[model samples]
Target: MDLKKLEEFILEVGAENIPLGMLTITNNSAAGQPVSMDNIRQTAEIYHSFGIPFFLDACRFSENAWFIKIRDPKYANTPVKDIVLEMCSYADGCTMSAKKDAIVNIGGFIAFRDPELKQKIAQNLIVHEGFLTYGGLSGRDLEAIAVGMHEAVDEDYLNYREAHTRYLGQVLTEAGLPVYMPTGGHAVYVDGGKALPHIPHSQFPAVALGNALYLAGGVRTVEIGSLMFEHVDPQTGEPVYAPLELLRFAIPRRVYTRSHLDYIGESAAICMKEAQAIRGLRVKWAPPVLRHFMAQLEEV
Candidate 1:
């Protein structure tokens, strides 16, 4: 995280104008990079200095804790659950998609350090979601989350998870794919811009690379690039694109084995070998917002 850039943006925008500040622990869009505990603390200090409430997009909190334990020597011996608590200590609240780290099939929740805020949010939740009693989830689902959240922080499970993801990154790199190094917690992101230099960001090279991977071996991936982050500058009326073109392979928990990961890495390598033949894409139709989710495209 660039502390200078964040502080600059907050200052430029005026802190009073900002409603709240949020930090995604495993910087999801940036190759799922893990944020260190020190960075988290410093960020919280900045937000609080501006009288802004800090929140966490903590769906993958456990995974991030594991990274902190392994990467930061200071926390090398700390328990995963303890690391998770310390990470959350800096935030005023957190929003979690229980489906991720909690390992539940469905259900999500927002937590707040202030009871007044919780009560206020609950009112909105009651109107849009189900009653505050269940929060739109079944008893079974809630129970699952209760059990799974504890399991999510199990050190043994996290160790295996890291190893599993690292293996895929290694395989992809060895097979000549440009993978993000020091592989992140939950996903292996390929540098699509480097892998498919023949295709340009204007034409959505990451999307094309994603499509190629699917065609090669049914290895589905998501494009985190111009297709998702591009926008027209209201002032200049020119396109502003994401800095990196990434193809993310999010490894699901306990869903696939190492062998399955091998297949995915092999598939990406296959796509890379014939990357020159891969065509760029142009949007055929798209929604005004979140075009990546529902957009249709044609090869350019």
Candidate 2:
């Protein structure tokens, strides 16, 4: 969930007096640090103190479930499905990213306990998406999601993925590269703050790291910082907050093996050891008429 945006929305809705609630805070394992559950709870408690009904974005419930089990083995016997349902009870409604937790190629869903709100939301969905019969997803994709959701909790599968992440983290750490301890989900984070202390945030640390890694080892990585919003112009665009420059290395589940991870670690180490400063370059960007994905960029 975009908590910053959500908080702003809450303030706008005149619900500043009402309490907000969130299930759990987990990091964008794909990004870097875990989202703080304590922070979320405090925010929710504040809203609750004001007598407002709070809702959680529970799309990543499965990941949180895995985290809980791994972090506290005493709860290992708890069923993830049950945990998800229980967590949903705290929220007025939830928006789920079926694609991630459900492992389907394309699917999403929203759940609410309030019948009136549920009906209203469903009505809106029917107009924007398809009817409940179709649910804006293909039948095959739904099937995949169902199967994937079931497999998402398998201890063996989760263990393998977790081990792989740890292995990647260990390799990078041992190589004396700046890495976040306690890797999250299925990604390893290269701490841009520590990796490139000399680089300023305004200079796009994540982008610099990504480009450096690519040049040093031919490995592709994405920057989580300012580079993500490179299209925004200083004069015309709004300012961005949070760490915009994070170099993220996402490990695909059941895809890349240990050997592949080793190669990635080796590449990262070499990049850290040999990276050079990047000189600034400026270019103009035009907003896309259609999909930005389809838009082409060329040197002017």
Candidate 3:
């Protein structure tokens, strides 16, 4: 979150209307960029001063921690786990999905600093989900999450993981592919707008590039730009647009080696060469909300 903008907004709104503030580490919607530790601390301070609790969407906490360790000079020698704890200390609680950093197959959990809030959460859990203990999951699943959390913070594993992602970005960039720079910990984002300038935003260029990647080499990717971020206004009927158009290739945890990424990069280069031939898409049918997730589209 932008602290300055938040402060101004809070002052304008008198802060009472806001219940809490949420921040995500390694924000997924924006090319998996990590939030700076100093920024997080300052945001926490701002929220606390306003009497608003700060929470974290920390699905990729380990990856974010590793990024901080290498990127930030202040945390150069700090252990990844220690850095992670310090980050968490600023926020009152966090919601986590074990599928990401934890490497668990399925399941998610929440942590809270307030015992009173935990008790309330337990009661709600029983009503909507299952018991507070397992929440419809078996003991084995919980064990996997516990162990995976520990493995996720291992310095060696994090080093290799981040390096692998950076390597893919470097290779694709060297091949003249328009990928986002300073490679994110999770994925390589291709700048679809620059790559497919012939296809305008209204025609969903990023979505077209994603489709082209799939058709070219059977490599599936998601567009994180206007196609995914923007939508048709139900009331005004105007098409809202996002600032940037991106095609993302999310690298699954411990799933592929450099050879696999090498093939992907080569495939992307080939696709870029044939990009002009790719046709843009127009939404044929879409729901009222989250249209990008399941919208039907056809060649424009």
Candidate 4:
């Protein structure tokens, strides 16, 4: 996170205008990059100083802890569980999608230090979801989450997972693809704009690159560029585009082998060789909000 930008924005907008402050641990939008421990603590301090509550979107907390262990020398020898605990200590609470770090197929949860807040959330949950005990999940699912949460913090498992992602990033880079530096915890992001310079931002280069990867080896990837972040400039009434066109290869946990990644790298290489022939796409239909989720498009 850009600390300067964040502080400047908060000051410019005025603390009274802000409702809540939340930080994503493994900032998924930025190639799953892990947030530093110092940054989290400082961010929480900033929010608390302004009388704003701070929360964490801690879905990949375990992976993030692992990154800190390997990247920051101060915590090089610290236990993953200890690192995780310290990370959470800086926030008032956290919301999680258990599917990511918890290693569950589905089901998520919210945790807070305040009992009053917990009661309020539970009351709402009872009205919309199920009872306080289960909260719409079966007992078995709850058990899985309980077990998965512990396994997620296992250093042996985390080491393997980090190495696994790095391997793919290395292969992609060696294959002449412009892969993002310092491979992230969960996924490898390629600079689609660099690969498909022929396709402009207006044409959704990231989407075209994703399509090319799919066609090359049946490998699926998500576009994290204009298609995902495009918006209108309210002041000028002009469309705004993302600065970087990126394609995210979000590898599923405990799935696929090195061979699979090799095939993906080869597929990307093929796309690079024939990148000039790739055509850009034009949106045909879209929703008013989050158009990328279900937008219809055709080659332009």
Q: Flag regions of model 4 displaced more than 4 Å.
A: none
lDDT string, candidate 1, 232-297, tens digits: 999999999889999898998999988898888788779778888999999999999999999999
- Candidate 3 clashing pairs? none
> Distance from true position, residue 270, model 3, in Å?
2.2
Per-residue C-alpha lDDT of model 3 across residues 221-259, encoded as one tens digit per residue: 888888677867899999888778988888999999989
User: After superposition, which runs of candidate 1 have C-alpha atoms over 4 Å from their true positions?
Assistant: none
lDDT values for all models: 0.91, 0.64, 0.89, 0.91
Clash count for each candidate, listed in order shown? 0, 15, 0, 0
lDDT of 4 by residue, 53-112 (tens): 899999999999999999999999999999999999988899999999999999989998
Q: Residue 46 in candidate 3 has what lDDT? A: 98
lDDT of 2 by residue, 41-150 (tens): 55556556556766766555666666766565655678766655555555566676776656666777776777997788778888899887568888888788778878
In candidate 3, position 16 carries an lDDT of 93
Candidate that beats the other on lDDT, 1 or 3, i.e. the better one: 1
TM-score of 3: 0.95
